[model samples]
Target: MKCEDFLFLNNQVCVIVGAANPRSIGYATAELFAHYGAQIAILDVAVTDTTQAALRTAMSAKVGREVDLLCIPCNIVDPVACDRAMQMVVEHFGQIDSLINCAGIVRSEGMLDIPSQDLALMLDVNLKGTFHTCQSALAFFTKQQKGTIVNLASVAAQRGGGLVGGAHYAASKGGVVSLTKSIAREFGPQGIRANVICPSMTETGMLDGNVTEEQFNQVVAGIPLRRAGKPLDIANACLFLASDLAAYITGHTLDVNGGGHIH
Candidate 1:
């Protein structure tokens, strides 16, 4: 009936990956989820005592309250670490209602310029890493018989390698799209929902060395919205897909690209 009633996540435990950076989509999602009354657990390879403290301080300042937060050190490429991280979240929070995977890496080199190791690393983190985290969370979700998953992909996956990423990055994200769809179909009957969000040219640290000022302005001009996407823009989509507001929506690729890549 009310706005909050539709999007509220009161007491829900949500695990968000790649949230250590304050300016990242993951952080914005954490802030918004906290605003909606969800308990947050962050997993990042860069998580440390200092980063965790800084994230807590930043989130508290943004949310205007002492947010319920947990930070775990996890490199999603390692399946063992992913499993351990999920177990820790459950041990601390008692349950995991949702898992939002925002962790990934991007490279801007041309296909031929991308070396063997670079391509391998790209797929390992972007594709295989996402798979690891999803499998880890689904282990618990399958047992609980109900859960939701929101995966952050890139518009590069849909429109090819014209954005900030290279062909390898686009290919990896395309894999992510296919992976989410398969999970949605396989696990939907078990009451688990999986969806992907493809955001275009978001204002996050990921664009720092990837896009030049001139290129950014040119890309924004082509976008119907005539502006770059903010982290909150993508985070809002994550909230909807991760909340009961999208109870019946699964295996869907919701584009938050400001009409940049209209099919």
Candidate 2:
């Protein structure tokens, strides 16, 4: 089939979390979804009028039209906030067809150096936050009998903490993977699909100050692809999983690594 024949998300309303930063995976996913004609609702803890305006302008330029975008301030660590955010999207868009969770934080501190507070914060935002958002979306999906979820985990969760994250981050992401699988199993009978994406050493602001140029090059040298993963690489995977293209797939963990951690 031709590429244009694969317009899978036309008119679908998709919710993307943690998309305030233009360089983030969340933003890339939102942009790609809009390119495929999906209406977008971006929820971020750092969202502001300025950021929202910039995002709207940038997206409009790229899409060659006035993009349908909604920006809302949300802290996914709070369940109430997540629920309210979902409600707001439904109110604005009439319904939500998919949710892509790219909201998370990573720390490079080792297990021995990780403080209790740091661990708690990591788990709260990465694992518990994912739980909250998924639960909130499931409320509507259960009633509608269909929905799709694409969650962002990390290679840290698989290889036990890699170049940019610590033990706490890995543990939190592991919980995310497990939680998504459980959701897929429990909600599959209801026609709700849930999946996880584990990206390795992506080119994002997350690497700034976390890994030096030397460290990054050293890791990339070992990968067969001879390069790091890109936000668009993961975004493409997300689009496929979120769209009807993968309707029969659920509870699967897709690795968007540049052949970095093949297993």
Runs in model 2 deviating more than 4 A are 1-5
Tens-place lDDT per residue, model 2, 27-96, is 9999999999899999999999999999999999998889989999999999999999999999999999
Q: Residue 239 error for model 1, in Å? A: 0.4
- Tens digits of per-residue lDDT, candidate 1, 1-263, equal 77767447988999999999999999999999998889999999999999999999988898888997999999999999999999999999999999999998999999889999999999999999999999999999999999999998889899887668999999999999999999999999999999999999999999998899999999999999999999999999999999988999999999998899999
- Each prediction's Cα lDDT score? 0.94, 0.95
For model 1, the local distance difference test gives: 0.94
lDDT of 2: 0.95
What's the C-alpha lDDT at position 113 in model 1? 96
- Candidate closest to the true structure, highest lDDT: 2
Query: What TM-score, to 2 decimals, does candidate 2 have?
Result: 0.98
